[model samples]
Target: MLVTEKSPIVIVGCADDNYSMPLATTMSSVIANVSSQRQVVICIIADKITQANKNKILKSLKKPNVIIEWLIPDYAKLTNAIISRHITIASYYRILIPELLPEKYQKAIYLDSDVIVKANIEKLWDTEIADNYVLAVRDMDIDATYVSSSKGLQNYQQLGIAPDCKYFNGGVLVINVEKWRRDNLSQEIINYISNNQQYIRWHDQDAMNAVIAGKWSELDPRWNSQAVIHSYSSWKETSLTEEMYNNVINDSYIVHFSSSAKPWKLGCKHPNRMLFFQYIDLTAWAGWRITFIRKLWLKVKDMMKKKGISFSQA
Candidate 1:
């Protein structure tokens, strides 16, 4: 398909050394799926990525119409933000994109490193933001209310937000850079994270939902089919109807591995996990797969750590 847009479509992502492979895989999928007629500029907020990995990433996305620009992030500003075993300070870097990029870029699509693009991203870029700060899909697994999972905003009542406000997954965001800058949304989100650290479960995602609760536009769930949609029972738990669930699972534009069980890791049962590897074959990390021995070793180490037996002691 020929894209008629005059300006380049700006796509933003964040990653550190640990997430370099997934980041490259995500961008490769974008390049593979995007229109050849449109110019694509990918701005990655890199945090301590090794030069070797940078070269691999560049090589993976080496296309005539695609340009890769790396921006070094200031980690010191994220010192007080909460992080978990799988989550890192890099997850919060999406909040910095508006100020980090040049003023000429008024809009951008922010994708998580764990996602694999299946459709032309120009379609997503064409989505109208209008007066909204962002356009995102509703979170399939969680909501605004604090429930048994402890994943949603715990202080919604305290924050004067309604109990039933829609909560969006931050995995795929079509951001309005101008709206964010005018409202100083990034700083407000950072301040919310700092002040309400105890209430943060999903960290930056939670902060963003809290700060921009009613201002964001909702996209179709097919745009961001989260990991939860893979399970029939899990899909029933969310707001999606049976048809909607099936549609998203069967034909997702972007498959997001939102759970801890990632496609690269052992025991990831998501049906689309192999699809991620399919995109991987199109990148610099082609033919890469985690070996069985390595998986077993990792499993054993996890079991040993749980049993309080350190590797040194063993």
Candidate 2:
């Protein structure tokens, strides 16, 4: 059943100016794909984004059904919280959704800046979390289980999580805002992260997994098709099956460029990177192309490297 809501569909995201264009590109796809009849509400956690960039987002989003709200939250409290390198504090804002949004919004869909929507956002918004805390997709390379003490369960055990507890990828989430606030999950997550700094490898993701392990509902693999090495190249893993890959390449609703091989950069092998560019064309960044000389140079360099030629030798 296609989930329909009487209330405005709440879509949440966070990003700095560095990703403003991509965020706009993502929002463009979202508004374009969502049903015209549905009222859309967008809330963004801004991280020092410029007024010019903000105007670009407003101009680019031109959809009549969408309403935009911006929030600038102080992240000073999270200074002691575990944070991974290269990941910004904006990425951590999703955890505070319950407190961040109005009371009317008892739930919200959190999307990462690095993703593009290909299907209706209502389908995700209307999904029934049932008895779970959140709805999310499983990771292609990372196992759900903590497995064992000597293995991947170090943080899991410290958090008193079972050996077989499921760990979800935090990129996309169907958050139960009421449940989060009711249970005071935000503070609990922060407390967990602060206490287990050594064990928190993925930082916010780990804290979320530890705090809400076995409590989230797993959505279909196609909803958040992460483009990992195993996904693109058939590297063997129990979590990522051949059938899953087929669904991702042929029928995914949202394609996530979750790894370092972002679609915007060169040498990315995700099958759906071009799909990202398709959305990019709709934004102000339209006609934007990776430099021809740079593209050719990268290819030539790749060919030379394959032939074992050193930089000086080349």
Candidate 3:
């Protein structure tokens, strides 16, 4: 393929051994949707990812115009980063992308492993970043008001952040690598996470929001339709209007499975769960299936639905 002279779309993703499949699935979705004219460079910040899984990821993304770069992060610096049952220390590796990637690349798009791209990413790459630190979608689940939810910034008052400031989801970030490097934002966010460990609920995401509040531009919600948008009650809780909600639900460019009930899991009811599986089937983990228990449960649910009996997991 003859690539264009335009700057290659640089994408950065982080993963460990457990997340290798999801990362590969994310890369596969990007490669599948991206235009052939543009060159895409995918940088995987690896943390103890096995050779076999790396091979699987490579096999999943077999595009002529797409180049892959494997980066080893400085784990020593990330040792103290907090992690939950589902998230790993690797989630903190995105903070290092500005310093780790080659200087020639001034900007990059960072996507979490638990997402699927449904449109040509070149459009997102072309967003006018100007002087902003990052372009991200407003987190639909977290309330901007400090008193509304504990999930919101716990120390917003202490951090001097406004009570009504918008909080962005770190899952999809259009980062201005040049600005991040110049301002030393990476270390600053790290320090915030360290100092506010007791108050930090969402780890790097909370730190980024605190350190870069009001600095990031908001992208269209369709670019990152989070799991919360699937339900009417949850979507209504967000600031999204009815028209905006309809647009995002009907035509999401990227479907982010940001909730704990992931598509790969047995009882996930996200509207895009099947869409996620479609991309997974295209990957090296083709024909991957949920356990027999899950399959049986699905059958039972289908039978109940046929009898007009609604089923909901408690």
For candidate 3, list the clashing residue pairs, or say none: none
- Runs of candidate 3 with Cα error greater than 4 angstroms are 1-5, 142-149, 234-236, 291-314
Worst 10 residues of 1 by lDDT: 142-151
Clashes counted in candidate 3 amount to: 0
Q: After aligning candidate 3 to the native by TM-score, how far in Å is the CA of 206 from where it should be?
A: 0.3
TM-score-best of 2 and 3: 3
Candidate 3 lowest-lDDT run of ten: 141-150
lDDT of 1: 0.84
* Local accuracy of candidate 3 as per-residue lDDT tens digits, 274-309: 887789899889877776876787678667756766
Where does candidate 1 clash, by residue pair? none
User: What is the Å distance of residue 217 in model 2 from its true position?
Assistant: 1.0
lDDT of each model, Cα atoms only?
A: 0.84, 0.76, 0.84
Q: Please, what are the lDDT tens digits per residue for candidate 2 over residues 65-101?
A: 9899987766865776654335767777787777878
